[model samples]
Target chain A: MPRRTCGNRAMIWALRLGLMAGVVLLWEWWAPGGLLPTPGQVWHAGIGLAAEGRLWRAVGDSLSIYVAGMASAALVGIPLGLAMGSFRLFGRVVDVFVFALAATPRVAFIPLIIVLLGLGFQAKTFIVFLGAVMPVVLNTYAGVLAADRDLIEMARSTGAGRGRIWRHVVLPGALPFLATGLRLGATIGLINTVVAELYTAVRGLGGLLAIYGNTFRMAEYFVIVAMLATIGVIVTEAMRAVEAHLSRWREER
Target chain B: MTHIRIEGLGHAFGAVTALDGLDLTVRRGEFLVLLGPSGCGKTTLLRMIAGLLEPKAGRVLVDGHRPEPGHDTAMVFQNYRLIPWKTARQNVEFARPGTDVSGYLEMVGLSRFADAFPGALSGGMRQRVALARALAAEAPILLMDEPFASLDAQTRELMQGELRRLIATRPSTVVFVTHGVDEALALADRIVLMSPRPGRIAEEVRPGPGMREYLWQRLREMVLNDPGSDFYGREG
Candidate 1:
């Protein structure tokens, strides 16, 4: 049975790699004048950017802004979410405002943010923060609310203090939900990083995209887009790994 | 002496009364079982004693003071509410932090599976972890609401015997609630039967040595055909 599973896994990998290669080959043959650049040319552009050290700088700038926004969101969102989830009175008071903020189109705030913070890292970070914080807050709140009451009661029965109950019961129970929120926030933060840079700044990957597009550097543009996509994939995969590690106890393995 | 005293205890959810005007006294280190049919307030009574539910009209006193949840009392629930994120050892250790959990896990025959999480354990095994956790806390009053009700017959019987032995070794004021007559007979020094909705005590019996057969028949009669029982009241 193990041998068969191993074989099946290998076959699945083979198919996935073959499909990706096939797409790149098809794109290469389609047209040289087309909007999309070929995978090989995109790869060549990535190497050229790397040689000039522009690729590293752009990547660094984007990541720093993204991380700053995401970290601040986590700092604000997690505790607020826990408070709102665990206490009915607090939840009632805060829910309306949180929902209103979450419902507004975050992209629409870019102009306002630029006006307030100017075309600096602060504006980009604020835009990303607005885009990302809502999901983390909402999901964390829902997770805390949805935690099994029986478990909470059990913890209470064990002479656990309020803090202990939150640590041992509420936090662990909400981990999967928190992971989902973080993954979503990371993705949205990426998008906002690009959007904020597009609207205001001339640094980061988004800025690079603008420069390449205006200069008709299609290969370079595609490379930057590819890099953004790769970052998104890597961040999501990392979040998933954390989720699995934390939730291993809950899953029937 | 009395470890827990319920005086004119009453509880209602909105318009539906679950328990009303009930009073009971549990002696220190005695295995007092609350035996009744469904909706007879057995659970409500247990919850009140555990300080998890507030009585609408009455009060529960633990050691002559109002009950304090997680301090004077520990409870094992029917659902075996173990923390899914913690292993068997951690669940037990949670009850009494900074204490070695192996002793409790060993007592429950779960020492070997101490590292296993609730999700990985069988229903009976999870219940054992819950039991071990409750035991480790060393609460003066132990309240259980049909803690083994979800187990299969063999496992239920096994758990019943295990619980009896565990309590015997470290006797506490135990108030166990169950619908299973055999279970009560097997575990209780005294049994209190309750009436249906708006539940009140109907009968109390002490099971003496070699009286299992007779007591079983008598309890069956009380459960199924009593004139003033909830059985007739619901039917009427």
Candidate 2:
């Protein structure tokens, strides 16, 4: 069984690589004399940028902003969601505001945010926070609201206090939701980070993309885009690992 | 010797009355079972006694005072309702901090599975954990709401026997609710048969000493004829 599973996995990888090669070959053939650069040229451009240390520096800058924004979102969103879910009156009162913020297009607010916070780390962080916070808040709220009432009643019958019930039952029950929120937040946060740099900042992967595209450095621009995609993939994979570790006790249906 | 007293206890959900005119007194160290068919409000009465619900009218007193959940009462639910994330040991510990959880697990024959989570255990094992947690709570008053109802027949019999033995070792004021006539006969010192809808005591039977068979026949008649089947047609 193990051998067959391994063979299947290898087959999947081979198919994926073959598809990528086919796409790259097609693009290469199509881009010979056009404005678009070939895959080989993109790979070499990536190597050249890496050698110059610009790629690494840009990565570092973008990562810092991304981390900051995500951290702030979690800090703010989780508690808000928990409180909103646990207290009915609180939830009702806050529902309108949360809905308004979530429904508003994040991009439309960028100019306003820039006018208020300026083109600095704070502005970039705010943009990412806006992009990330909605999913985190909504998922956490739903998780808390969706907690098994029977379990809470059982806990109470066992002499557990309100705090103990929340800790033992509500929090652990909400973990799957929390993991989902983090994964989504990571993806959107990365997008916001790139947008922030592209629109306002002088450094980061988004800034590099903007500069390269404007100068018709097609190969380098593709590399930056690939790097952004890689970040999203890495974040999602990491979140999935955390989710699996935390929720190992669940019996899959 | 009365441990629990219910005086004209009544409750309703909107227009549908769940329980009404309940009056009873449970003696200390007695195993009292509330026996009724489905929707007869046996569970509702048990919940009220456990302070999980407030009576729309009347009152319940335990030890001459209003009962409180997690203070003097511990409940075992039909669904087990163990925390899905915590291990059996952790669940028991959460019931009453600073208690010997392993000892409680051992009592329920779950010491081997103490580290297992609820999702990993079979239905019977999860119920055992719930029992252990209830025992660990060290409550003088025990309320059970059809605790073994969801177990398979074989496991249900095993659990019934196990519960009987456990109670024999440590006597408490136990109010067990169940729809199973046999279950009541096996575990109850006194069984209170309830009428359907707006539940009230239809008949109270004491299957003393070697009267299990006779008591079962009598209680089954009451369960089927009195108010339940008459209202719901022989489905009782």
Candidate 3:
């Protein structure tokens, strides 16, 4: 069993390296076939965009909407989750509504969001927030509910006040779940941002892909697809790093 | 003033009566162990004395007053209740967060693992951290619920030594709970054994000098076929 587990780990590493190599090889092949943009052409485009400062501008615009939408979701969702989790009454009152939100396909609301928010940045932000809120709320509530009863009693027995008990015992216990929710929420938020840009004809990688699709420029569309994939990977990796750091600290005590 | 007293103590969960009409007394600076089988209300009694549970019928008094929430009380739990996020020093520091942290760490011989978290440490090491936390609490009365029960025999012996050393340094009136007769004999000044269900004080045994070697023979006769003495209902 141990040897097989070791072999499995080795296979995973090999597969990851092979996947990276295969993507580069296929990109080179398909670029010539007029379905993929060459590395050279993308680099040239990157440099030109940098010179005009449009690359940074594009990044800033997307991030501004992303951060705003995420913040709004967190402000509303986390507090609601905490309230729902901390009190039996609140949990009973809102559990059905929260479940409804979780089960709803957020993309289904894009058309309704457009009608309300119009084809502007507000519409994009609205969609992003819609995708981001549920995970945070659900995870926070579950984490609070699942915290160990003995730990809470231990804190209380030690002359700790109610506030201190909540801070020391409850908050730390719920952290792992909250971290999980935030990471997943961020990914969903990013997808919604790009989708909103695509549907509304705004200036984003998604919009750029849409323009390319209209002109039969499959290589450019493929380039935007690559960028979106990279963004997803980067965001997920960042969240994973944060989670690892917290776990390392948590495990040591 | 009596340091600990239980009067007409009664508690029940649904139809099951865990503790009933139990009256007890613990003097200051005495090591007393409550020994009983599983589901015998040993832990429930300890928790009530520690002010974790409210009595359904009567009252528990610690230091001449009713056991109150957040009093001068410290319990070294069987589960080691060490915060998972904290380092060894951090866990001890949690007991006295505003004081000098290094002193408690040094006292527990955990100065090296001040930054090491609970998951990285062995069970014995984690229990040591928990002991340090209880000591740092500076409570006059300490309550321990089978704190050494989970450890291996060797580790349990060393922990017993560590606990004895701490008891010598700082004399705190403690109520210790366990199922092991040897453990109750080794560390306790007074060993109070309870009946099976609706636990009551069945017998109180005091083993004098050469206690460990002597009680081994006496307790053998009282026990059922040298049954394995596992404090928390697990096999030793």
Candidate 4:
């Protein structure tokens, strides 16, 4: 089984490398004169942008908002979910509001956010926060609700305090659900961050892409899009690895 | 000293009476098995003894105090309801994880599976974790509801031997509920049979210190000559 797994991973990597090589070769056949930049030439443009600090600045600008927005969502969403899920009264009180928020189309609020908060990073952060919180909150609630009743009963029967029961039984049960939510939230977090940035004249990848698109700088535009997609994939894969490790601790071997 | 007593124990679920006017006394270090078919209130009685449920019309006294949950008594559920997320050690520690769970796991012969999670365990192994949790409670009374019924015959035998050894060593007052006549014969110091539907004690029979041969003979007599003498065909 171990050998098969290794072979499969190697095959996938080789396939990816081959596809990347093939795509670059095709791009070389279609350059600026052919209405597309060659892969080698785009690499050169990317390097020139980096040397002039425009590319790095755009990258840095995008990352700050992404990290800040996600951190805010995580900070608030997790605690709120844990509180709602672990306690009946709190969960009941917020149940209607949570469901309503979950159903609302987050993208529709982009115009409203930009209007209210103005053409700034704050507006972009607001949109990302709205988008990122639902999964974390919902998953956390599910985790708490799914906690084993027997385990809680056993604790109660053995003179464990209410606090102890929550700590020992409730928290561990919710960890799996929390990990799942956090993984999903992180992905949507970046996407919403970029989408929110596009709502304003923000000097980030989203804005850059918008400008590049209008000016027909297709090469730079595609490169930025590719970079964003690659970043998303890498972040998601890393989070999945962490989630797997956490989930496996509670898994059947 | 007496460990427990149930006086005029009666309970009804709204309209349908599950248990009616039952009385039982458990002496210290005695192992009493309550035997009955399903719907005979065996589980209810066990729950009452464990303080998981309260009698509507009676009281349960343990060591001269009213039985209360989180004190003086611990129970093993038949379903082996081990928490899926918890390891065997953690489940055994469900009652008191920081205490001497190692000793309790050894009592149920699951010391090796301590770090193993419930999801990775067999039905019998998980039940042993339940047994260990109950044992680790250090409660004076132990109530088990058909804890090993899910296990195969061989594992059941092995667990019975373990229970016997545990009884010999700790000597707590035990109330075990089971539907199987042979199981009651093998385990109990004294056996009380309950009739089905509006359950009540039909007969109290002691099968000679729970010896193998004595149980065999009692099993024979229980089936052949007077099975209905106990119930009188009054059940619905």
Candidate 5:
């Protein structure tokens, strides 16, 4: 059975690789001229950016901003969500405002944010934070509200005080939802990082995209887009790994 | 000596009364079963005794003071409410911290699966963990609400035997609730039959010859007369 599963895994990998190769070959053949750059040209452009050390610098800059924003979002959002969920009066009072803000487009605030914080790291990070925090707060709140009543009752029956019950039963019960929130927050944060770079200081890969697009350097533009896509996949995969690790007990079910 | 006293115990959910003007006394180291049809408020009585619920009109006292959970009682719920994230050992330890739980786990015969999560265990095994947890607390009272009601017939019988053996070795004031006549006969030293809804004590019997038939007949009469009784649905 183990050998059969291994063979199945190998087959799946082969199919995925074949599909990717086919897509690249098709793109190379179909879009050789005009605005579109061939795969080979994009590859060469990526190598050029790497040789100049611009690729790593842009990646580092973007990642640092993304990390800072997401970290702040989690720090503020989780506790706030917990507080809202735990305290009924507080939740009822604040939820209306929270939902209203979440419903509004975060991009609309970018202009005001740039005006206030200026086109700098702080402004860019704040934009990412705005994009990331709502999902974290909303998901965490829902998670706490949906926590198993029977489990909470059991804890109470064991004479667990309110704080102890929250720590042991409520927190652990909400972990799967918390992990989901973090994953969503990370994705939104990355998107906002690019938006921030473009709208604010025009730095990182977003800056490269603007520069290359304005000059009609299609190969370099494709390189920047590919870099962004790669970063997105890596970040999402990392979040999934963290989620799996956090809920190992739920894995059997 | 009396271990627990319930005086004029009454409760209602909105207009639907569960228990009303009920009074009972439980002797120390006694195995008493509350047997009735579904919706009979047996669980309500058990919860009040566990200190998980407060009686709206009356009071439940354990040894002259109001019952307080953990210090006064440990409970085994029908759902086997073990924390899914904690291992069997950790779940048992949760009942009373700062004490070795190996003995309790062994008592439930789950020493081999101490590291296993409740999710990974069978229904019977999960209940064993719950039993171990309740036992580890070493509380004066053990309140159980149909702890084996969800198990298959064979497993339920096995658990009944296990429970009897365990309680025999370590006696406590036990108040168990169940609708199964066989279950009550197997476990209880004295069984208290409850009336359907607005529950009150109907009869009390000690298990012996012809008692099974007598209880079944009484239950059938209650089910026939009480339109709200879910007994027929449950038995069928």
Candidate 6:
């Protein structure tokens, strides 16, 4: 069984690599007079940026903002959401406003954020936070609401106090939901980081995209886009790893 | 000695009355079963005894004081209600922290699966963990609300026998609620039959040679006459 699973995994990897190679070859062939950069051109552009140390700086800048924004969102959103779920009166009172804000497009607030915080790291981080927080809050709230009532009653019957019940049953039960929220929050935060860099200040990978696009550096533009995609994959994969760790008990094996 | 006393116990869920003007006394070391059809307030009464629910119109006293869970009683739920994230051993340990739980897990015959989470266990195994947890608490009263009802027939019978053996050794005052007549006959020292909705004590009998048939007939009659009973269209 183990050997069969290993062979299956190898086959899947082979298929993935073949598909990627096919896509790159197609893109190379379809490139029409600078309309798009060839894969080789994009690779060369990426190497040039790396040699100049600009790629590292942009990655560092973007990642720092993403991390800061995500941390803040988790800090504020998780507790608030849990409180909303735990306290009936508080939840009823605040849910309308929360849902309303979540419904509103976060991009609309960029202008107001710029007016208040200006084109700085704070502004960029706040923008990411705004994009990321709603998902975390909403998912956490839903998770708490979905927590099993029977488990709560069982804990109560075992003489667990409110705090103990929250710790042992409620929090652990909602972990899968919390993990989902964090994963969503991380993805949105990365998007908001790019948006912040593009709209607010010309910095990070987003700044590189704007510069390359404006200068008609199609190869460099493609490189930055690829870098952004790579960052996105890394962030999402990291979130997934964390989620799996948190919910290990959910799986039988 | 009276271990538990419920006097004029009445409760309602919004507009729906669950239990009304109910009175009962449980003796120490006695295995008493509350047998009733669905929506007959057996679970409601058990929860009240477990101190997870408060009566709206009356009171429950354990040893001459208000009943408090973990102090007077430990409950085994119909759904098992074992914490899915906790291992069987950890779940048993949770009943009373800082105590060795191996003995309780062993008693339930789950020592080998101690590290397995509730999700990994079968329904019977999960309930065993719940039973272990309740047992570990060492509370003087054990209140079970159809603890084996979710299990298959064979497993239910096995669990009933296991429970009887376990109770024989521990000798705690037990109040078990169930709709199964065979289950009551197998485990209870005395069975209290409950009427349909707004449940009241209909009959009390000591289990003997013809008790199962008698109880089945009574349950059938109740189900037939009580149109509003949730047990309608279901076997007694």
Candidate 3 has an lDDT of: 0.79
Q: Is the docking of candidate 3 incorrect, acceptable, medium or high quality?
A: medium
Better of 1 and 2 by DockQ: 1
Candidate 5 residue runs with Cα over 4 Å from true position? A1-15, B232-236
RMSD of each: 3.8, 3.4, 4.6, 4.9, 2.0, 2.1
TM-score list, all predictions? 0.90, 0.91, 0.87, 0.86, 0.96, 0.95
lDDT at position A83, candidate 3: 80
Clash list (residue pairs), candidate 6: none
Give the number of the best model, judged by DockQ. 6
Give the lowest summed-lDDT range of ten residues in model 1 chain B. B227-236
What are the TM values for chain B, all candidates? Answer: 0.89, 0.90, 0.88, 0.86, 0.97, 0.97
lDDT per residue for candidate 6 within B1-236, as digits (tens), equals: 89999999999999999999999999999999999889899999998998888899999999999888997999998888888888999999899999999999999899999999888899999999999999999999999988988888888889988998899998799999988888888888999999977889998999999887898899989988888775532222
**Local error of candidate 3 at residue B126 (angstroms):** 1.4
List the per-model TM-score of the A chain. Answer: 0.91, 0.90, 0.83, 0.87, 0.93, 0.93
lDDT of 5 by residue, A1-253 (tens): 2487579878987998899899999998899587698999889999999999998899999999999999999999999888889997999999999999999999999999988999999999999999999989998998888889998888888888888888888888888888899899999998999999989998998888888889999999989899998899888888887887777776352
For model 4, the docking class works out as acceptable
Tens digits of per-residue lDDT, candidate 6, A124-211, equal 9999999999999988888889889988888888888999998898888788898899899998999999999999989999999899
Pairs clashing in candidate 1?
A: none
Alpha carbon lDDT at A168, candidate 6: 91
Candidate 2 whole-model C-alpha lDDT, 0 to 1: 0.86
lDDT for model 6, please: 0.90
Per residue, candidate 2 scores C-alpha lDDT tens digits across A1-253 of: 2487579878987997899899988988888676788888989999999999999999999999999999999999889888988897999899899989999989999899889999989999999999999999989998899899999998888767889889888888988998898788888999999989876766799899889989988989999998998889889889987987788788522
lDDT of 1 by residue, A1-253 (tens): 2487579878986998899889888888984666777788898999999999999999999999999999998998888888899897999899999999999998777778888899999998998999889999999999999888888888877767889988888888888898888889989999999998888878899999999999988999999998998899899889987987777776674
Alpha-carbon shift of residue A94 in model 1 (angstroms): 1.8
DockQ of each candidate, alpha-carbon based = 0.64, 0.59, 0.51, 0.46, 0.68, 0.71
Q: Candidate 3's error at B151, in angstroms?
A: 1.3
The weakest ten consecutive residues by lDDT in model 2 chain B span B227-236
- Cα lDDT tens digits, model 5, B75-137, are 999999999889999999888877899999999999999999888899999999999999988
- Give the alpha-carbon lDDT of every model: 0.85, 0.86, 0.79, 0.79, 0.90, 0.90
lDDT of 1 by residue, B81-163 (tens): 88888889998999899999899999999989999888989999999999999988888888888888788888888888898
